[model samples]
Target: MSGQNAVREFTAQMSVREGRWRLYVALLNTTEQWPEHRFGHSVPTFMDRTDALSVLGFAPVPGAEWEWTEDSETPDDPASPVVLIAAIRVCSWSGVSV
Candidate 1:
């Protein structure tokens, strides 16, 4: 699949949670098809509504303004760290904390 297509698919799979805050998490494949290439690396990234808007590079839809924050914790092993991105809804989607 093409890189753009892959990204689109990843975005489509994002799920939104509702309660105190509404957020979405999506795993992104940052690497190209060829592992030899410098861009051929995959990592999971989380995006809230605002982050998603920034990524999509356009003005957000009406009533879709929300803020998100990223939380990362070091693993007990110390060798690995757990990273998380969460979207925290602020007044009318002012900004994201990530």
Candidate 2:
């Protein structure tokens, strides 16, 4: 696979520290292969850092922002089953972090 394609297959995982948030991106590969699969991406944003931390079972840290990507694969037909590639977390105060 090309380097760009490899990066796309990777997911970003984020965690919060005392007053800062850390991000970790990882590559993921699937054993199963399917044709004509649809892919999608999304980010989770929170207004308050506390709220974001709460869901992560961590205490609210300073300069915390809520952000994450929701990536998945869906079938073209409504009745078709859906597949989730991976959940990517993008932590940033203003916009999504790479």
Candidate 3:
């Protein structure tokens, strides 16, 4: 349970607000271990992928890698097995961890 290896999973969504793409993200707490977990935040639109990562607090550098795996299920449907409108993994940078 070392903090260094801890991976934070998040479910992200992109929507147009004020005619610009914005990012909303929620922490995926599978274990329910943290009762204080909160809902996602509405982040402002970013200039680029690097800017997006920086806004999300992942100081992404050159060669930094991440992905947005599509989730076929509808996020509004509770019965859906997956809710990944966009899935992102917070991995160590230097920048090649998934």
Candidate 4:
């Protein structure tokens, strides 16, 4: 399968404001291929590096164009260390079993 059609994982780092906007765009971009595309119908999740490593078993893969974010003040919510949002593609094709 071509890269566009192939299921893959992507990670983006952004502030809360930017992250929300990205989520919106991803939803729009993948709507036509809902459940088929990586971002299609996918609720992108925001996670910090630490949680991603420990809980999600994430490892850094190359080839992502990093964007610099300006640190800004946010409400006091320590539980929300969501700097990294991962967009992972999923494909399920059950072939006929003989």
Better of 1 and 4 by lDDT: 4
Better model by TM-score, 2 or 3? 3
The C-alpha local distance difference test score for the whole of candidate 2 amounts to 0.34
Query: How should the candidates be ordered by TM-score, best one leading?
Result: 3, 4, 2, 1
Over 4 Å off, model 2: 1-8, 28-98
Stretches of model 4 off by over 4 angstroms after superposition: 1-5, 8-11, 17-28, 32-47, 53-60, 63-66, 71-98
Model 3: per-residue lDDT, tens digit, 1-98? 35645544444444433334445444344432211111234433333544555555444334434454545355677676543333343332322212
In the predicted model 1, the residue pairs found to clash are: 31-41, 65-93, 66-93, 68-87, 68-88, 68-96, 68-97
Q: Write down the lDDT of every candidate, Cα atoms only.
A: 0.31, 0.34, 0.40, 0.33
TM-score of 1: 0.21
Question: How many backbone clashes are present in model 2?
Answer: 1
What is the lDDT for 64 in model 1?
Answer: 45
TM for candidate 4 is: 0.25
lDDT at 92 for candidate 3? 29
For residues 1-98, what per-residue lDDT tens digits would candidate 1 score against the true structure? 24423222222222222212222333234432211101112332433334544443333334543343443365465555434333322221222212
What alpha-carbon RMSD in Å does predicted model 1 have with respect to the real structure?
Answer: 13.8
